[model samples]
Target: MTYPITRSYVAIAAPPLRSIPLHFSAACLTGALLTDIAYWRTAEMMWTNFSAWLLTFGLLLGALAAIAVLIDIFSGRLLLRGGLGWLYIIGNIAAFVVSLFNAFIHSRDAWASVVPTGLTLSIVAAVLIVINACLGWAIIRQRTGGLEE
Candidate 1:
């Protein structure tokens, strides 16, 4: 066996995953805000103007998500995991899928018909989901490293 003389090491940045709860919640809220703002601005263009229905559903979902996230955010614990986390994931995934459909199939037909209401708003949802996923994954991964609650 031979021994080496000099050793070189590369430094890798550790991600700021400790703040996943706050990051995820904040991103989700921001994403929703963006999508809603865009929707409100272009409400006149959509074929379906179910503003009341959309408002009710959005409030319900947003309240539940905000509550769940707030619990964890305030406590610095994974208060919402497993099913709750999955619920959030499912909602975001649904938004992403719907946006994909709107962006590609429904919205592409006409420049005016679908772009304003379909894919353009969907992109905001997609971004929110992406941010939430990254934050959630970081929190979960930190568990294996014996991070403090």
Candidate 2:
């Protein structure tokens, strides 16, 4: 008599977007927002601390996330739930717009009180980004059937 052998397959829980991309997005945005805040508070030379580089890096990360999101959306790997995903995109857009305005104002005069206005907007955007990132991770975990993988 021959014995039957069975193989068991375990499913890995893959997120909508990998953790690295999401984490990169959060880190870059947080760094940009903090540097901007520091400049706003101290009226110091923002560029001395490489604020420009930080902002550029944050924007690059955001762009990468955007590309990944679009690809996932089109390929049906990520489903738009009209919640965190939309909020994430919106927050990024708002942050970009505010950052652009801040850059313009900063070019005019870094010490002006008006500089804070753009910085405030950026802060709000950063908060939204953070919230959206958390929500996104939760959603992905839920979709993948509980964070086992």
lDDT of 2 by residue, 1-149 (tens): 99899899976645555345656756765666677777767767754245555555666676676777777788776766767667656755676666556445444555552355646655765776677667666667766668544
**Local distance difference test, candidate 2:** 0.62
RMSD per model, one decimal: 12.8, 3.3
Q: Report the error of model 1 at residue 37, Å.
A: 19
Best by lDDT: 2
> On residues 40-122, what C-alpha lDDT tens digit does candidate 1 reach at each position?
46654342333223433443454455565566546655534556455555655565455444433332333343345644554
lDDT of 1 at 114: 38
lDDT of 1 at 81: 51
For candidate 2, what is the total of clashing residue pairs?
A: 0
lDDT score, residue 43, model 2? 69
Q: How many collisions per candidate?
A: 0, 0
